[model samples]
Target: MAGNSDPLTPRAKIAVTAGKAVAAASRAAGRGSGSVIGGRVALKLDPDLLARLAQNLDVVLVSATNGKTTTTRLIAEALRAAGPVVSNALGANMPAGITSALAGSSDARYGVIEVDEKYLAGVARDTAPKCIALLNLSRDQLDRAAETRMLAEAWREGLAGSKAVIIANADDPLVVWAASSSPNVVWVAAGQMWKDDAWSCPSCGGVMQRPGDDWFCGECGFRRPTPSWALSGDHVLDPHGSAWPIHLQLPGRANKANAASSAAVAAVFGVPPQVALERMYQVQAVAGRYDVVQFQQRDLRLLLAKNPAGWLETFSLIDPPPTPVILSVNARGADGTDTSWLWDVDYTRLTGHPICVIGDRKLDLAVRLEVANQHFQVCENLDQAVQLCPPGRIEVIANYTAFQDLRRRVGN
Candidate 1:
């Protein structure tokens, strides 16, 4: 259904049609949403299909180790106030999944994409985004992804000479170093909760000096840029010093930072801060991050935390002590094969809560919890885990694949 002005060729049209058919078949087979496989088939038919599908629409690319999916969803919601926007709302951030999303909505006026950190440069080249949001960079999927500093360097090199307006996090040193190459950047003082990855300056390999919410490199003079937009407690302050109070349905301070970044990106698209914030306030969940579902007379709140940085933020979102928490983890390909990152998290924080562990890697988690001097019950499955808990609201935090499995089982 692409308009006449769009550059999709006859072969590309056929590819898109075939991809739709494949997607339909995949959905029927219950093999997943079929976005990635469908787009893979389309690209096989037409290697230039992604660029062709992205021809005339304004595009925005969001990339980060964490919060890419949530921030992409927030920005997409805010942009929808302006016009029809197509986005990978299901947390699909790869090239294939992105192409599938665009191909599904040919007539959309705007395309908001979530690009994986490693694939940001390639997707940006194809989409020619109008704006790019660079959230914090932290170590995730270490078995697969490059180290934090290397990824920051790659972002810096990959985004060089691009015409896109970069909306970056000023509080994250890795993000600042990555976005500094761009001539046009809107810096947002989104607070970074996990600072372990940025203790050393990425620019000069020198020790970083932090004093009173500001950071500077002692060896090379690299410092945190003056933010045009900042998050001050419960309110977001614009460059003009106008504070917009954010009342989002999402929980945690991490989401507040995400909102600040989203509002900045929406402003570049000519959306007012108030309008953008109002629109973003409507989003209660991203993919399945904070969805609550019923299971065996108990309310299960589903939370996804993939890395140490993510886990640090997720801990604050849980209900207070004695509210019972269920922690699940998996070391599948989607999640990193290495479970060494488990040592990085402070599981001891859940000391007073009734905790249950269930996953493919439950034993590994049990060892970590044991080492942390925390008491927990190791269950065979979710049913056993829930049965052990008193019937009430329980928090469930899972990593990537385990979260998906729980979503399927709970039918959320």
Candidate 2:
């Protein structure tokens, strides 16, 4: 009784059974329709079960500050294009989510799972993936996660024992430092051919030499080596262009980074980089991250701004004349408990009076935007936002939940 009553004893299979039982109760209670939250509760029922169960299949672990879902999705797509590959296609990045995804797979030679940074260590212990892709780290969810440096350090320590081939994003200092720990690391970054906005050392707090596509820390002189898989383009780069010219369907220079990251992993697994790029371009948007739609006579392009960094990236994609725009903030606790970071983003750049009112914590967003006295059609929810969308090239930039809400409202 002293040693055996542990919660995670019987492992993930036991967790699965317990989860199903709890799910039945949740369905009875009319709770969430998602799998991760409750399934996570169930996953704790079995600790070692996942390791044992995962032994039969080769796995790929993909984690990033922003692009994990899109990159992993593209990686899975390329793998599928080549042959059969299984993954958590629904953007479940935690262990419980992993369990929920694994529940659906029948026969998969390769398992691609996007992992959450905080939980990666525990998950990695159980699921020693055949190849692990450590994407770049950034500041996000300061309330929940430590700084980017802390996450990178933790991840490096967590993945030590696994013999899986390591795929690292070489451009970011945090990732570069983590890659140093693994001797078998296969470094991947958008070749020194894309764009460089960062010039600060993540460590030592010094300026960096933006020499070409690569970077050099001036104070410490910690230089990131040229990545193995790289994008090929002058001003025009395929985000997935390590397999350049092959990926035509996927557009945008930022997308080239996404595609390149996926191509890197696919290449390590013997899938030609070009083939991966071709498969990636076949499907463009990863859910809400810049999905375009034809609305009435105008183009409603949905760009998801999860944080300040994402908003900055979205601004890079915006080159057209600064027209009226609507930025939606989700107030739902489910989206995230905090809505304060709206101020962190440089929303002031789109200087022209934004048709921005209030949303989500409607008062909060409107109050912030109102500092600039931007026009706002304050709505109770997304239903009202869809109604307020003006005609002609409507750019619908939103947070996580609002993106789906808007899509459903527009009937897209």
Candidate 3:
């Protein structure tokens, strides 16, 4: 609990107490995630809870179709150079989660939060954040989030005339369109690995041409914005060609891009680029991502792939002639009921890689892999999958719920 001299008023205090009590009871009952329910109750009691908690804080909001959690963690790690940083690192990125995080850490003056794609605008308005990290947009949770272009337009409308300094991905055309409305913008070429969502111009509904790293729409004048920061090979290069060597504990070019995005936001906050990059090296995992755990006498490195775009980036992270890979998919409420997005992915990329399928949607994955002509075995369960995998370090790629289940099973 915060100190007695906390800034919250009497009504806010009552709301916070009720929220904490509900959280405690929920945890004791093992019913559901206490973070969401508790926050919902608190907001119902004190509607202005978030706005009050965000007072005098340097709030940084991170939102994307993917990588938001990891990028938010990276930025939070870098921002620690300033002071104690409060963040929701548990992958609960809605109003309830954000409120719970803020109400829990009232003393902290800096907050690095990962906001869900649909809720970014509302949260940004409530917090009036100092900086906003706009990463690439893609097709994720099509049933829940609708189309990626719709989100881009909503973001564009939401961020109009906002004083927050926007750090945006220049490589993603959708991101560029979204952040264009912000008056203060810093564009970074973080490299868009998935361009399927941006093949057509969001501005004029015209076909986009990608010549080298630059993209232009011949029908509309919309083109890739000139970037202030870029990733050249392994180094994060600035305008002067000075390189900041990023040695991350998290393996992947995608993570390196995430680190660069964080570094860009940190720079805008007056933190040195070198300090930001150095801090990012210390982050090995975010909410069970890229964590190696021992289960049933085998070592498994966990990676979360929720959508086709995410799968594309995840596949690039694997080395040539990959290790034994366990691919699990679940079409639960959290993972989205629709699993048809699997066809959008180029599963042929994993043709040479040994694979195993596990989850409620295992058969669906099996059929998809068979159609792709990728050899894979369907396991009865995760343990069976582990038993069937070749002896040595194995990579386990799972969707949302399956990833959470594996993390709990590994005693994370």
Candidate 4:
């Protein structure tokens, strides 16, 4: 087996050089970071480019419907305590992006990759990672991705006989079902706030009985496995019963849950819980998720909430009433063309806050807010939206593309 030094073959070297040139050209052309396009071109030139690039590195793959990017970033930071690490830091999570990241840093000792939920199986197969972190999964981009159960089954089937250690979330039934097939697994009791998708058992299609934090299928005897690591309020408890305080710059219980999972994955790489938590504390933002930008004398704390589950978490992190809140939604390809998912989120949570809506799908959000009996103004853009709020610190929560658009406008 290849170890720390896996030199690229001649063919791979040519492919990497070509990909780098394309990526540079793309950046020069202002077409955004060329990670995806570069990877696509490299893959077309060499079909086995990703597998080849991942040859001798200790790779870790993080996948979920939510928190995957943040978790991936956390895990990467934690792993850096041991050695040099290469990661798709920009949230480009597909095979091409992963390939581009790996090809760029062939000498890095570790690879921390964030895999798209639907593409986890393929990435796992290619990388043969040392550890795979399976975070919570819920409905997202329904038009482009399969249902959560189907994705779970694919995860189960794809990772059946893998040698890698699976670090999985025990609280999520879908994640539990997916990781159950793996023989070597480390379970983390990362809290699952969205229980709508996990009500039915993925195993027997039976009703899942939830007693406290434990969930089980009464019909088939499928149950939540005992976790080795657990999140207790603001602390993470390891198997040895050691409590490590999770003091992260990132807000929300969801991020604390991500920290717990990240600690478990870091432990797989021989990084202690305390050491991992300390390293993860420095991560203030993940690709502009919680970026606080200065705009029009008001500090705009940008929060990215792509789906219902994500929105629920974002609401918990926002400031209370009187602190204005901006809700933005865009139905672009990256944000999922179907804006119907907006209805799944409870807009009533913003009832007390002074609300303003802006984006391509602002009308959709306005109708939802109106139904929730929340008063909101539909603004043309972020400039107008920020102008509506009283100066100070304000919360700006936006879905995928809308958040990206805002970030671009703010020069993030």
Candidate 5:
């Protein structure tokens, strides 16, 4: 076991080696995904090592239905802006993954991570981070995550008495409602998610109606106040209108919500407000998320379509070229044991273009696209799809496993 030896034991070496190989494969496939072999192997060698390792870090953990990776990257960048920081790098958010990230660090005073909701409770208990961040809950991975309500309850229960400072996004009624259970919570706010339609009073299950962008409960008239640290219409600010500019590198209206959330969390570690904003601008899209590529003189938005919400977001970003667009799905068990989820995603965004669908499961992707009332073509493989895609501009929408396949076909 690696436990009987120094930091770089045989198990640790094997884990690190395996992680490097996995990461290399991911990179060679043209995605920037991180690996968890470091932490996984560490756990295999000695089960109780995470607690011992936790004793040496000022760890910060972030979790949410969406935006966890981008938010984690921003927090890491902000921490790095403040001082040296160690990170898992691939947004690996499990106990083993976090351990792997902290495992190989030579100089580590601080670490930041984005964890998945299902694993959050367990990981937090094991790691005992100094600061914890929670983003708003949203519909995602219904087959695995149950319901958003279930996730909110589980997260709050897991965080019940942790001494860590809780940085929570308060604009969402559900998120705010759950955070209220913890009096020690530090609320974060953003203007974009301020939709009165989505808000419901937790006390009475009555609609919480909005008045001039502020809200009040319709049933009992119990009202939750606006957030103390929210992003203003065009600028970032504290409660007192302290105008600040958060330079977010990603495009779209929703990125603002993520940028604001990251800034609020960075403040917990004493990173300057402006640096959080600046680093957001420095934050580029991670691989397979909203990655754009230029192939054969054509502009391609190579995005990963996972759960329904994630697919909806991609549809919003993809301005389907006047020419046919390439949409691909993978059927490998590792990619997603089942590919039936393609039916749930809204494909209305594929309008106005003849879509080119490609993958091992070409029929499935084509059927989904056709169901949405879009003209479509099926390709046996991405190699053929790329060839058919006009040389000037191509937008490739793909599944998780297909990301590597696409990169291999595209040669990075």
Candidate 6:
């Protein structure tokens, strides 16, 4: 029950040592994936390691169906003013990754963590974070995450038992309902573009109606929460109506929203709004999410598109016609074996572009593209695919595993 700042039990010490050894070996063997196996070993030995490592730390936990990683990165950067912050920048967000992050930086005073949505409750219980940032909820990892409404209900149940302040997206009805029961909440109108999974109210099960920028349920009176922190155009508005212009190198309107959400969290932790916004400008790439790198003697910009919502947001940032884009997809376990979500995305958006589809799921993507009337070709090899694209600055968009593969291949 000791806090993370407290001295670890002798057994926990041994566990940490052993875990680090395993992590080192994994790295030596070219199989290291952040703290994946190492943290698992540590937790297996001390079962209560996360709680122990989280002791005495000002922890901020972030969870969402999308943007958790980038948001976490932005929050972590903002927390730097506090000195020596612990965070799992490696993109491993389950219990193991969190455990590794806390265990390695047991002396740190602050922690910023990205948590998988399905495991948020347990992680929250273990870390007893000072604040929990809830981003928009949508259909994702259908095989593992089940239903979005159920996840929202679970989040509602979990926050009801915690004292952590909830910083949530007010535009997401699901997020609003999830944090409704929490006594202390900071709402931000960070925007939500995908509504396919939120037609019915989570609380009343009644069809929700959207008029203007807000939604209300006629049957049960459920509605979008009034936002105290709002993102309007290129500015973030405070509760008092003071606006801070946000200029981020990260592309897309979603990144601006992510900055607004992170700024809200920073404010809760006593970080000045201006200071938080300034810190966010320092982040150019988050685990290869929006970094441009060289591959096959061509400049390729990497964009990670995992689901329908993700694809929709990422596609919007691509430059208009005459820009060639390479689409890569894989049905690996990390990418969620269900490639059916391919049909859910509005591929018609790529109608005029010359699309090069490649990956384990290239055939599936090709079929989808063909139906969408997109101009396309299938190239199994990424290098060859790059060669096929038009000369300057190629845009590469990929699903989970394919994106990781590209990052590894390009040395990002």
lDDT-based ranking: 1, 4, 3, 6, 5, 2
lDDT of 2 by residue, 1-412 (tens): 0122222334555677777676667767766435675566665766555565466566788887777787788889888865667787768787777876765554666788888878787877788777888776766665677567788779778776668788887777777776677768877665422123345676676888876566888799888866666655522132343235545444455567767777778877778766777777667667655667776656777777676667777766763655556677775644565777777766666666345543556677777776855656676664455456666666677777776677776666
Local distance difference test values of all predictions, in order: 0.92, 0.68, 0.88, 0.91, 0.69, 0.88
lDDT of 3 by residue, 96-180 (tens): 8899878888668688989998999999989989999999899988789899999999999999999999999999999999999
| All candidates: TM-score | 0.98, 0.83, 0.97, 0.98, 0.82, 0.97
Give one digit per residue, the lDDT tens place, for model 5 in 15-92.
555655665676677554445654665577666666555556678888876677777887888888777778766767
True lDDT of residue 355, candidate 4: 93
Comparing candidate 4 with candidate 6, which one achieves the higher TM-score?
Answer: 4
Pairs of colliding residues, candidate 6: 3-55, 4-53, 4-55
Off by more than 4 A, model 2: 1-33, 191-212, 234-243, 246-251, 293-299, 322-324, 331-340, 352-354, 367-379, 383-388
**Candidate 6 local lDDT, 121-212, one digit each (tens):** 99999989899999989887777778899999999998885789899999999999999988999999999888888889888899999998
Candidate 1 — which residues are off by over 4 angstroms? 1-4
Q: RMSD in angstroms, candidate 2?
A: 5.5
- lDDT measured at residue 230 in model 2 versus the true structure, 0 to 100: 61
Off by over 4 Å in 4: 4-6
What TM-score should be assigned to candidate 4?
0.98
Clashes of each: 0, 13, 0, 0, 4, 3
Candidate 1 local lDDT, 324-391, one digit each (tens): 99999999999999999999999988989999999999999999999999989999999999999998
Better of 1 and 5 by TM-score: 1
lDDT of 4 by residue, 1-412 (tens): 3665556778878889899999999999999999999999999888898988887889999999999999999999999999999999999999999899998885688999999988989998888899999998898887887588999999999989888999999999999999988999999999888898999999999999999989999999999999999999999999999999999999989999999999999998899999999999889888988889898899999999999999998888788898999889999899888888888898888878999999999999899888999989999999998998888999999889898899999988
> What is the Å distance of residue 202 in model 1 from its true position?
0.5
What is candidate 5's local distance difference test score? Answer: 0.69
Candidate 2 at residue 1, lDDT? 7
Q: Which model scores highest in lDDT?
A: 1
Question: What is the TM-score (0 to 1) of candidate 3?
Answer: 0.97
